[model samples]
Target chain A: MERTRAPFAALREALHAAEERTRLPVARLLLLVLLLSVPLWPMVDSRWLRILVLVGIFVVLGLGLNIVVGYAGLLDLGFVAFFATGAYTYAILASPASPALQADLNWWLAIPVVLALGAAVGVMLGLFVLPLRGDYLAIVTLGFGEIIRILLLNVRGLTNGAQGLFNIPRPELGGWVLRSLDQWYWLLVLSAFLIATAVGRMRASRMGRAWEAIREDEDVAAGMGVNTVKYKLMAFAMGASIGSFGGLVFAGFFQFVNPSSFTLAVSINVLSIVVIGGMGSTPGVLFGALILIGLPEVMQFSETERLLSVINPAVPFADTTDWGRQVASARFIVFGVLLVAVMALRPEGLFPARRPQARLPERHESTA
Target chain B: MFWFDQFVNGLTVGSVYALIALGYTLVYGILQMINFAHGEIFMIGAFAGWAVLLLLGGSAIAGPMLIVALLAAMIAAALASSFSAVVIERVAYRRLRNAPRLAPLISAIGVSIALQNVALKLTGGRDRVYPRVFPTGEVGLGDFSVGYIQAFLIGSSVVMMVGLIVFIQRTRTGRAMRAVSEDRATASLMGVDVDRTIVTTFIVGAALAGVAGVLQGLWIPNIRGTMGFLPGIKAFTAAVVGGIGSVPGAMAGGYFLGLSETVGRELLNELPGVSLPNEWRDVIAFSLLVIVLIVRPTGIFGERVSKRA
Candidate 1:
């Protein structure tokens, strides 16, 4: 029995070491390959490109939300306010509303402006909710989100009200207008990748640890010389800025800005992505976005009566009225069910963070 | 005269707000989680009431029969809303009890969306008009006029509020509910059926919301798939403003919110060179929530519970 135990122990130790070695680097390489290969694919269709752009945008939003939710442990139900701020910032600055730019401002200029506006809004929102925590914080943020949406709706002269701001010019670089959906796809992919990497690094840094500490126990974190309030605000601002960045890209890509676009639904979608992706994990956020966005697009056939008819002979797939409404509404139900399932079965997500290894017990202790 | 009109309008609206706020406060007091689906439950009640009115269209039912139908509508709404609440607790929240606080919260949002969509599908995404079952006669006193529908709304809301208060203070079930809200494990140890109490709390709150929904349909004369959204949100704001987890606080908060919205709109319109449109009423309500949170996170009457260890 002792001889057999030695081999089993050796094998187990070897497997554990192998897993520890390959886990992060392999994941990084795979992500790198996926990112690099997407741009080189020659047969990428417009529809596929559009899907990619959406995935990238949501990935960024999810990452930003992860900062507040996963790191700071703040339940911000109104994260879309930052997204709106970014989109509106780009719209008002680049569109005809601004006499100085007049649709002539470079995309680069608008990007920074959007980011700044997003950060500014994030800081303001953070300051506003500095004293509140938990459920109260959630409601207050929710109210703020509605307030922003209402402002956008009511301030017709500035926002063009429900009609929305349109005719947004595409990103131009040195007289080259990148108007194709594929070009925008590449831009979004690059931006999402950069933001994800930065967020991942941030999670590993001092501030990230502070956030985790605060999340686990606020009083303990504060007692341990950590500035709880500062770290919390940092998480909020960073998340908000990232969300706004995604919004800026989304606005430019769609060439439209409207109050309807930045609803509570958008905020919920981003939150779900983070939750499904596994809180506090960067690659998890990307994976979550891809699944949430890409799966529906790929499975668009499942929604069609013709496809369903072929699959099932007994059930009639025809006579389904309001296909558009059903399609729109189905997303929420599917997301909700998935969220519940994930929380029940795998709260840690598909790929959980690796825990630090502990040394084997000393021989004396084992023998005793 | 206009000021008096605005004040009366505010008071009437405030009463409705108090009704809705009671539901939020009651649920929050028990679970310590803001039932995001509470608003959706309120929406369900409105739709249920609308359905009842539709069924009784053109019927020559006298006073007692009309009261029966209204009671039936309230019962239907309460049943539907309670079922929804229970289902949400079982499907989305039960398993999440030991998980992070955010887990239940996010799940609640998911449930909220799911319920809203289900409601949208059921209601066909259109405004379902309530059949004009109630008379629109007006009662006048010293140049002041109150419509029958308005009077019904205010009177019924006040009665409901009083009944709810009495139930909480006097009933054994209500005592169990209060105990559970105070401390779940202790309440259970003390022989209170925590789960049963929770279900009962939800049923009671939903019944009140159901009544409010019917009254709203009669008073406002329109019911849409999304009609409950604004009212639900306003009521929640009222609950918070009054003092979440406090029964009396909810009543006070609801009336305050209703009054604020009504008076703010009227006063804004009357202000020279500062005309505010009616749609901005929601903005004002939400802003009030933000300002309240900034000033007093525990709300006006809510006592702070120590953070969970």
Candidate 2:
């Protein structure tokens, strides 16, 4: 153990040094991110902007999931269920195609309802799995996810049964109709920023400490006078509401809500982003979304075709080679390989969250 | 008569589920982790069996030749599944044994995705038809009857279970596996090669799943890349229902789930205005899992889950 840890400790120190070099203060980093993203809408094409929006959406999801699986130590595999609930809820209330309600609710007016619905669903699921631990919790949540999809597919009257609710209304603030890709991208970016800030604050609060304790050991946390149940429920509700928010945005952006979009794969994708981005780390989630979501979408571009050919001169083009198409299809495969490789080599993720350092009073010379 | 037929169908499907469930039970017993990629290994087994059957001359062979081909296919599938399982253990699991529990599971999910997509790409995203090996026939006893393929499936499953029980009870490697599962640290201290025992467990479990895959292909007559997902989840449910770490428990749970899905669904349908479509089968299985988890977390066999979980 000593021998093995020697090299491991060295590696960790080197990694810490590298992290310190790149680490910017929170305020400056936020400003830098905002400044960089400000140019994205004007500089990139609609397609790229759309992809960035998707990435931003996933970042929000990753952060939300980070609260549950990362900070709270609850591995909720059925997270997509919450996302679906949010999207379906929004569509059902807002879309003209909605067979049941067809309230034609404005998108802004629907926010509180959608958020509350998301939180309610999360708490309901939390209540169900409160007793379950680790893998059991995971499988049950996975079942829940499947159950939601099945319900969406079969519930003909409410969900339109697989035909799905289309013509979903987009968010319109006052007179300005927010329909453009850039507008959606900005909305997502802003939402992600807000969610991240809230999540960071949550991680530092008393509730956050309670969640950490519960995550470490529920029985121990309970013994330590922490109300494990309350904190766990809080974490679930918080995470679920954020996930639903992502779903609401997703429905608005696509102007459609379908059961097919919410599958085990979506849950896995979000979970992967959170895991590969360094579980509890906010920046890690952002980085993860960029690499996992952004890279795949970017690879579909025509420019990437040329880039691929250049990378491997032996690779042919068009029908003879068609490496671009093949690569695009192979993205999930790459994702899986990356997941395995990361676990094998660096299980902490690409950007592991730093533990808050304790501040100590400087030693007085007289006392010394 | 309808109930009887459903019972037989349940048994047939139950046998396959039991086989796959054994894999989950074994791995979970040893590592206390879910191997999410186990389903993909089952998929590989189906493809392997299909390949062997094709090589043996499609659906034309009959009698003794068909028997030989089927045996060969099962062996090939077992080998393929075992190989894949071992690689997964080496690459995805072995290193993460001491890491956070989420790491291996997420990695396993990744493997499942990767394997499924690879199969989709290789097969051009189409189902491969299995050659008709079992002769189309059924034996009847008054009002009761079972198809030839169904009989073969049930019979083979029993034989495998018996063989596994014997192997575990009598073999040195099997003893090692049990010891490791009972207590890995102590087992290692006792001079048992913990790693080898773990690999052996994976091989044994995966082999059963592989053969189950072949059986499913033979039963369904069509095998696809994404074929393993549903059955895999159902079998995992079976494992949990019976008792995750218990072999006999898994077997019983599989049959229980199978019966409930088929006969139970029919039973529910018997109630006025309770007619359920076939797709509801999966829903029943999932609901049963949730109910079991909620009401009796320790499972029917009572594996003392609370302490471990």
Model 1 pairs in collision: B14-B255, B17-B254, B18-B254
How high is the CA lDDT of each candidate model? 0.76, 0.86
- Scored by lDDT, model 1 comes in at 0.76
Error of 2 at B289 (Å): 0.7
lDDT of 1 at A331: 63
User: Per-residue CA lDDT of candidate 2, range B60-168, in tens?
Assistant: 8787899899999999999999999999899889999998667888899889989988999989998789988779888889679888889999999999999999999
Highest DockQ against the true fold, candidate: 2
- Give TM-scores of chain A for all candidates: 0.82, 0.87
Give the number of the best model, judged by lDDT.
2
All candidates: interface RMSD: 2.4, 1.6
How would you encode candidate 1's per-residue C-alpha lDDT over B1-309 as one tens digit per residue?
A: 666677767777787678778888888898877776777777788788767755765345457778888777777877877787778778887777677565676677767766776666676777777777786677877669777878778888888888888899899998998899989999999999987898788788877876777777777767765666667778888888877899988888887787778787777777788877877888888888888777877788877732541
Query: Compared with the true structure, what per-residue lDDT tens digits does model 2 show for residues A1-368?
Result: 13335886665455444444565344435454773576354658877887888898898888889999999999888999989988999899889999898887888888899889999999999999888887778888989999999999999899998899999988887888997877787778777878887888889889988988888888899999999888989999999999999999888889988889999889999999998888788888998899889887787787887777566546355353766667767877888887898878878888888754532335212110
lDDT of 2: 0.86
The worst-scoring run of ten residues by lDDT in candidate 1 chain B lies at B53-62
Candidate 1 ranges beyond 4 A from true positions? A1-26, A35-44, A97-103, A296-305, A313-329, A348-368, B57-64, B269-272, B305-309
